[model samples]
Target: MTSILPLILFVVISTVTPGGATTLATASGANFGFSRSIPLILGISIGLASLAAIAGLGLGGLLLEFPSLQMGVKALGSAYLLWLASRIAHSGSPNAGKGLAQPITLVKGCLLLWLNPKSWAVTVGAAASFALLASTPNRLAILLGTMFGVAACMSLALWCSLGVLLSQLLRTPGHWRTINLAMGALLTASIIQTWR
Candidate 1:
């Protein structure tokens, strides 16, 4: 149990941070509703778990060994994040007249996890840091993946709930735009921090 303490701490901090998954979940909850955002939340948890499993299974080691490949992935992830931020910044409110922007789908939510540089970094770090706890790589992967999934679900739900609560105060397009701009700015800052 003590051996797993680090893993728990890592999961809690990673999930609670303002990353791609949390940002999108919050935006979805605010733009749509708690019910509409359920699929996105589920997708994020599953996708993050899958990524962690891959990392624990030793793919992370391969990426670390190939500096160029890792760099490429980071570049791509950064680009994708920038694009997502732009979309969020421009997204219209749900109550906006006809042709309202559609909410993020489950598939997109899952894809976001894959494109998120922070997810890859966190998974790789966790897999490498907690390697001593499991006797076998497979066991380590499964354990880490499960723990991450559970923690991600809980933390993401809280972010979404906070967004839903905030939605109550957002009565106009201007209000929603303000929220979206703030999210976008945070995401952009995350990208800058990643590169630094």
Candidate 2:
């Protein structure tokens, strides 16, 4: 149990911190409510787990071999995140006609992580750091993937719940605009931090 504590800490810290996915989850909760954000939460968890599994299966080595490829990914991810931030920043209140009418779908949520440089970094780091979790590489992959999935589910839910609570306090269109802009700025900052 003691040996697993570090892994737990790492998972919790990685998932709970404000990042692109967590920011999106919070915005979803605030705009669409918790029930509507469930699909996105599940998709993010599953996508994170899958990425961890892939990293453990040796994608890390591939990235290490091709530094240019990694740079390409980071560049593409940053551009995509910038676009998402713009959308969030411009979003109006749910009650207002200017806001997004539909919640993000499961597939979109999954793809978001896949395109996020931070998610890749976290998964690859976890796969490398927790190599001792299992004897075999395949077993380690499964264990890390499962662990990440569970942790992500819990942490992201908490973020979403916080958003729900904030939504209650921010009912007006102006208040929601403020929240959306703040969320977008935070997400943009996260992206900038990832590069540095």
Candidate 3:
């Protein structure tokens, strides 16, 4: 626990960021409810935890050695975020057709996790910090994963509840569209932080 403080701190910071995984989760949960968003949430957890573990184990330094690799990662992250924004821009209402629900799919969830630059950075940072502080790498990885997992869930739940509230209160059809657009914009804005 003592060695994992930095990992916890890193995850808490990222989990609270505007365009983190919680943003996507909230948006999905709002539009389709918790049942439909489970896949996405799980994908985020697995992807983030795995990446964070890798970084904690010394993968980040190796990654940094390759400038092209870093550039590619950034570019991929930016492009993916832009694409998500576009999807939101084009999507119809969650309840557009009678009894129709556009649920969050596994593929999309994977994309959200795999392409999120902020997630990668946070994961790497958490890993690096834990690695530095822990006497054993395995122990550090578990602690980091546990800390991040809890913080991420709590933060995401907050956003999801907020999304649910917004969905119910902002009954106007256009408002839902706006919420989607807002999420997309936030994702786009994350690029600035991720790149820098």
Per-residue lDDT of 3-23 in model 2, one digit per residue for the tens? 888888998899998888899
Predicted structure 3: lDDT: 0.68
Clashes of 2: 0
Q: What order do candidates take by lDDT, descending? A: 2, 1, 3
Maximum-TM-score candidate:
2
- All candidates' lDDT scores? 0.83, 0.85, 0.68
For model 1, residues 1-196, the per-residue Cα lDDT tens digits are 2378878888999899887778878887888888888888988898899999999898877777888987887888888778888887877677773222776677777777887767888899998888888888899899889998889899989999988988899988889889988888877888887776
**Count of backbone collisions within predicted model 3:** 1
Question: Which pairs, if any, clash in model 2?
Answer: none
TM-scores for every predicted model: 0.92, 0.94, 0.85
Q: How many collisions between residues are there in candidate 1?
A: 0
Which ranges in model 1 have alpha carbons more than 4 Å from their true place? 97-100
Output the lDDT of residue 65, model 1.
Answer: 88
Note each model's CA RMSD in angstroms: 1.8, 1.6, 2.8
Ranking of candidates on TM-score, top first? 2, 1, 3
